[model samples]
Target: MDGLSGQGPAAADRADTAIRAIGLIKDFGDTRAVDGVSLAVPRGTIYGLLGPNGAGKTTTLRMLLGIIDPSSGSRVVLGHDRPIDAAPQIGYLPEERGLYPAMHCREAIAFMGALRGLSLPEGRRRADALLAEHGLGEWARKPIRTLSKGMAQTVQLLGTIVHQPRLIVLDEPFSGLDAINQARLEEMIRTKAREGATVIFSTHVIAHAERLCERIAIIAKGKVAFEGAVDDARAKLRPIVRLRTRNADGPWRSAIPAGTRTSGRDWEFELPESGPEPLLRALIDGGAGIETLAIERPGLHDAFVAIAGDAAAAAMKQEVPQ
Candidate 1:
């Protein structure tokens, strides 16, 4: 099981959900930060809270971690009705990165673990091992001030998981990371999940969520625009069809749907629900000179555009809060 428990079947089943939020809402003074967001994160899986900047991803994460109380609604983490009661079993990395510049890298990690009730000596031991395993062994005694932004972020991430919490919540963990460090962080996330940790992370980059999460919740304007398996998200839109034709105006043009448009030498449209066999047969029978034809699967970005529209799509490019 994902949790460190010896409960029976029924209890184990109850523990299957690492986190659940129902109708969550958070209002900051006059501004409503999050509204009516719900999510069920399965145990031992990588769950992504995906949204553009200022779309409530951070707020929702805060609510889940009990860092902030919701204006209304409820949340459960690690089977605790109150998320705060489950804090010992959770590891959280906030969106804003912070570390004492004077603190050594290993001590910083150990200090974080100590905050979660781990003994300092054990925390330090785990910290040293984690840094070394992630190729930061040489920097063990170095102060946080010496590390680059990416390295500092890495040090903090190592701290987040040093206690090995059952539920790890990271708000935009990919931020401030270079490509190489991003790849390393991804590998670490996968390693933790394989060890039966339930990892929930927020990210505006659809590509990170695309590559890492088994399930994702797409938030837009403080609400969940879509939620389900990543594959389901990709399945929202039909396959795309791209064709290169020798003749643009011909009887075979009838096989092309009305919405199909010409792009350079290619004709592009959504593959009809009935399947491409009929369309291909029609084009062939009509003697359309087909130079090339490609059927493409929709990615998470395309599905986001389909579900949340263009405004939500624009958030994917934003790095700051809304």
Candidate 2:
């Protein structure tokens, strides 16, 4: 709550932005799915939309992509005030997977590229090369129905990138990937960013956003709760100091804060705003022998739980993609 944000893009920022949404809202019948969300994603960077399921992450993405119109507000994608007009240069992979079951993996990838205007022959050549590079050469001729769920997902991801679009939008891309494949996907995102493509991905998984995003917007109750750099998110919570003492009980114990948690000889508490030096001096003057001292900053996971609340944390269940 300390760093809540929904900054609108300034006029001078338009030239460098890959996508800009100002007070986007969507309504399905009487239900308001998204409300007053604003974001400015810079070109050639990775941005993340993070939230629990049913938190309107998908709806916001859909409105931004021109797949659905916003009931209020507006979005601009790749210089097109009308997002659909810029469709040729944008690659989108929706949450639900759909592909022709009988099509061979190679042909399937090429077909996806063709839809984006890549010639079939050129698409096929690029597909083969991409498959080989990604350890899927042998699966090229296999039918989509024959591959396992993980393998099928990989094929779809390959297809998503075959055309090398200027902007790529992926919804819940890591939902079903195992550890290895997830790492591969992370690397692929980095590679795309290095090649100057702007990418936006939505996920409930905070780790992916922490690792890959240059900036992020955290959605809760269909609104932007927090948006900024990952480091900024983590800074909302104060760093904690963990201390170990040689003495079991001493006058120094009185110097500890009221909320300090103790375990055996260790004491942990948040570093006060006045700073840790005063506390350290107090403990030392009280004759406590400091065995170890550590100050640790909160990670994104901790900051997320702090900012989004316990309900959101429980909803994630710390799910590792299957």
Off by over 4 Å in 2: 1-11, 318-322
Indicate the TM-score of model 1.
0.92
Q: How high is the CA lDDT of each candidate model?
A: 0.89, 0.91
Q: Which prediction has the highest TM-score against the true structure?
A: 2
Candidate 1 ranges with C-alpha deviation above 4 Å: 1-13, 320-322
Q: Model 2 TM-score?
A: 0.93
For model 2, where is the 10-residue window of minimal lDDT?
Answer: 1-10
lDDT of 1 by residue, 153-235 (tens): 99999999999899888988988788899999999999999999999999988889989999999999999999999999999
Error of 2 at 304 (Å): 1.2
Candidate 2 per-residue C-alpha lDDT over 95-124 given as tens digits, one digit per residue, 9 for 90 to 100: 999989999999999999999999999999
